[model samples]
Target: MNTLFIFLLLSTISSTLGQESPDPVRDIDGNLLQSGTEYYILPVVRGMGGGLTLGPRSDDLCPLDVVQENLEVDNGLPLTFTPVDPKKGIIQESTDLNIIFQAQSICVQSNVWGLVEYEGHRIVSASGTPGNPGSETINNWFNIRKFDDHYKLVYCPTVCSICRPVCGDIGVKIDENGTRRLAISDVPFKIMFKKV
Candidate 1:
């Protein structure tokens, strides 16, 4: 009987250690982020332009790249988060999500955010189709991670078990035209979510 009790104790400990509880992402008001609810991703740092927005691309046929508004007062655009599991309603930290803009665009039918290779750099852009979460739409997967006291956007999709994706911290790259475009960088763009 003692041997059986010891085995059960060990089993309980091992199972508990294997399961990790999801960390809920909170907004500026300290409320948990609900999936499909509109939120504005604003920079925590004062002078880093405004929230995320779509910028004009030289090629009209291609989708617009995600950028920060040059003006300090501009809130940019509002976006919604859709978790990898369509049934999940809460946005959790480090979980794959689809960041979709609430605005309309004529250049692309879908305003879902996705990564694209432009000028030898991986940049975030629109035209992504969400809902299908896997290696098929890996580029469309993004996540919010806890950074210091705020949060930052990260591109590390785990939806595909066999696909290898370019994982990195999402930051801004200032182009010659002075546009602050979102790109993969060593330094992350510190951000915070504000419910709209």
Candidate 2:
């Protein structure tokens, strides 16, 4: 009887740990977003300009900051969403993940989106190395959360248990030059993933 009780307890724990989130992140066509697949993170709001692109916020910088394209132009580089555990195959909502741009940046070698402090605000830019999920590269991790009927990008990573990362929703902040830059804000930038 004791053996059966222990076995049942372990089974319950394993099942709970293995269970996936209630909703898996899907593309515009209602298809599950697979790991390593290329997609464009587009804003759901009508006049939010275009998808995410890479450019310097001010004078030429090494790691080009992420910015939104012009309103009439929706051409932005494709991005790959990689979950912390690649074995999961599908990206589930609220799971810690890494977003890497497929295109190469002339300024910096890394194309992974990471948070960097510029002008007293945390802004998303391409300056991260993939795979290291500790406190060292805690800024590299991101999350896609469900917002209303759409979704939003979040910077709340759970990869490091001992690290207390500043958690916030990712939104757009216009720079002095009138460029929309992705930054941590109280109001999230509602978005949807489009598979390329």
Candidate 3:
């Protein structure tokens, strides 16, 4: 299905069948989110090889690169969104989100924060996944929703909602010469999200 059509469908569905209403979609300035929760994420367009997952990452590669590189080698497993801090609604690729079965965070320590302006991209960062340590504000906040019966991380930004990862595109291969590794296409990422 077309991405726009799907988004329109989700807009309609989210208004009625959607999970939370008037639920504070973004954290532009206010911090309206609980602390310590997991929300899975997906890319706008499924890349040539795999999907986007949220989880821990080193300070070197951007968070998304962690998945992009790993999935290319290992089986393409999904990822989840863990918050850096519910108040700030920030997320960076750190061990704080390394909860078991946790979604591999893509916001690297160089660093990246997934959701805030949107909705439940994530909700508060724990001590971090088990690697590096540090945090930041929600300049790149976004949200995901149950759109058309699937999950998606929608990033229709007002300003600076997302960062630049030139190598994020499919088949782009690794970031040569220290190019940015994160990428968000015009299409929002879609994935299967369950509350388990």
Residues 1-196 of candidate 3 have per-residue lDDT tens digits of: 6999999998998788754423332222233322344332323344433433333333444333333323422233333344323443443211122222244334433324333211212222222233232334222433444444443444322222253422111122233443212334444344433221
Model 1 bad stretches (over 4 Å): 1-18, 59-62
Relative to the unseen true structure, what is the Cα RMSD of model 2?
2.3
Per-model TM-score versus the true fold:
0.90, 0.90, 0.34
Separate clash counts for every candidate: 0, 0, 31
Cα TM-score of candidate 2: 0.90
Better of 1 and 3 by lDDT: 1
Best first by lDDT, ranked: 1, 2, 3
Q: Lowest summed-lDDT stretch of 10 residues in model 1?
A: 56-65
Between candidates 1 and 3, which one is better according to TM-score?
1
What digit string (tens of lDDT, one per residue) describes model 1 on residues 1-196? Answer: 9999999999999999999978999999999999999999999999779988888765454567799998778888999999999789999999999999999876755889898888989989887888787778999999999999999999999989999986999999999889899999888999998999
Q: Estimate the overall C-alpha local distance difference test score of candidate 1.
A: 0.90
Error of 2 at 166 (Å): 1.3
Model 2 / residue 177 / CA error / Å:
0.2
